[model samples]
Target: MTETKTIQKTFWQKYSTLMISLVVLVIYGWALTGLTFSGIQESAGEVSSSIFHGLTHPDWAYVYDGSGEDLVSLILQTLAIAFLGTVISAVLSVPFAFWAARGKNEGKLHPRSTTGKFMLVLIRTFPEIVLAIMFIKAVGPGSFAGVLAVSIHSIGMLGKLFSEALENMDHGADEAIYAAGGTATDVLTLATIPTIMPEFLSYTLYRFEIAVRSASILGMVGAGGIGTPLLFAIQTRSWDRVGIILLGIIIMVTAIDWLSGMLRKKLV
Candidate 1:
């Protein structure tokens, strides 16, 4: 009887807090949202109907027409922007990542200098679309503006990723190089870079894939890419042409995903 009582007490002790917490959360949510069983049913019905209609087949005739050129050009331009942006960002991120990693430097300076940290924060805080718009205004519409926009945003993103990778690196190699009286540059070349190379390449390629998609959209703001064609098609109410553009985008993005997946598999 004593053992049975102890077990019962333990079970309640472990679960009582969780049970109470769940009850409180549910009550709070319902009170705040004013949600009822009827509301849930209504929402479910509306969502189901909307989703059903949205999935209907697109116009097929556009695929055979020559209107696909705009989409094809937009896609190519977007790819070009993404590719250039990623390359520029990768190049710039390397030095920043090297400086940001701890134990890689024995100086009085912080692992990430105040300016560097602030710049990274600033770059990350702004949306890439906003940057693209701003650049479009400054540089006028074209692939170059899109590339600059993506590059700036990518630098912030990749810098952080590269820094984390560097931090996780083994200290032994860097320490050994320093002990051998190697300079910072020498140590970075001989030890830090080689160790982090695979991760760096993998991240860069992954960013490239994302940039390609983003570039297409950036064209909506007059930044050059397939987005321009898409916008034109939509404005003209040319659903047939829109269909072609959508199909091309789908194919291109899928190809990029597949290629990147294969590359990542080899890298990792």
Candidate 2:
């Protein structure tokens, strides 16, 4: 009986916090439900049926349009934004990563490391939309704003990932290089970079994939891409054009995902 009581006490001790959290979440969810309308709008069924009809009958012309401002061209613009953003961000992240990484000259305890982390946090605090808006105001709307926003946001992510990769590297090579009187640059090129290259490439490719999606969405804010046209179609109730644009987006994203997946698998 004593042992049974001890087990019961231990179970309650282990689960008490979790139970309390669940109770809080349940109460919050119940409160939210009260704010929802109890009935659907009368036009809901009509709107749904119209959307279904539009999706079923997408505009084939838009799908294959090559007239400079067509779906294909817009998609290509989005691709460019994603590609350039990833490249710029990857290049910019190198110094930040080296600074923030533990056990380097600017390791975690160093002032430079703290500064690097602070910069990364500041960059990451704002969403891409906010960054895009700022860039739009600074440079005017177009793919330029989208590219800058993606690059800035990606720097924060790539910096953190790159730093972790560097920190996790085998330090024995670095130690050996240092013992052999190799300079910092020599050690980095011969020991550090070689060890972390695969991870770095992997992270870059992953960021590129994310940038593609972000580029598409950035167009909604007039940053220039298929998203702008898609939004226009929705606003104009041009269901056929929306369907075509959606298809193009789906195809583009899928192709990138497949390509990136294969490359990542090879790296791993």
**Clashing residue pairs in candidate 2 (N, C-alpha, C atoms within 3 angstroms):** none
Q: TM per model?
A: 0.75, 0.90
Question: What is the C-alpha lDDT profile of model 1 across 1-268, one tens digit per residue?
Answer: 9999999999999999999999999999889897545545647777556434433445554444455454555577678999999999999988776555554454436745545656677888877789988988898878888999999999888987887787777878888999999998988789978988999999999999999889879888888888887888778755556666777788999999999989999997
Clash total of candidate 2 = 0
Cα lDDT listed for each candidate: 0.80, 0.90
lDDT of 2 by residue, 1-268 (tens): 9999999999999999999999999999999988956698899999889888898899888855568789889999999999999999999999999877777444346777777788888888989889999999999999999999999999999999998898788889989998999999988889988899999999999999999999999999988888898889999998988888888889999999999999999996
Candidate 1, position 234, lDDT = 76
Error of 2 at 14 (Å): 6.4
In candidate 1, the residue pairs with backbone N, CA or C atoms under 3 Å apart (3 or more residues apart, or in different chains) clash, namely 74-226
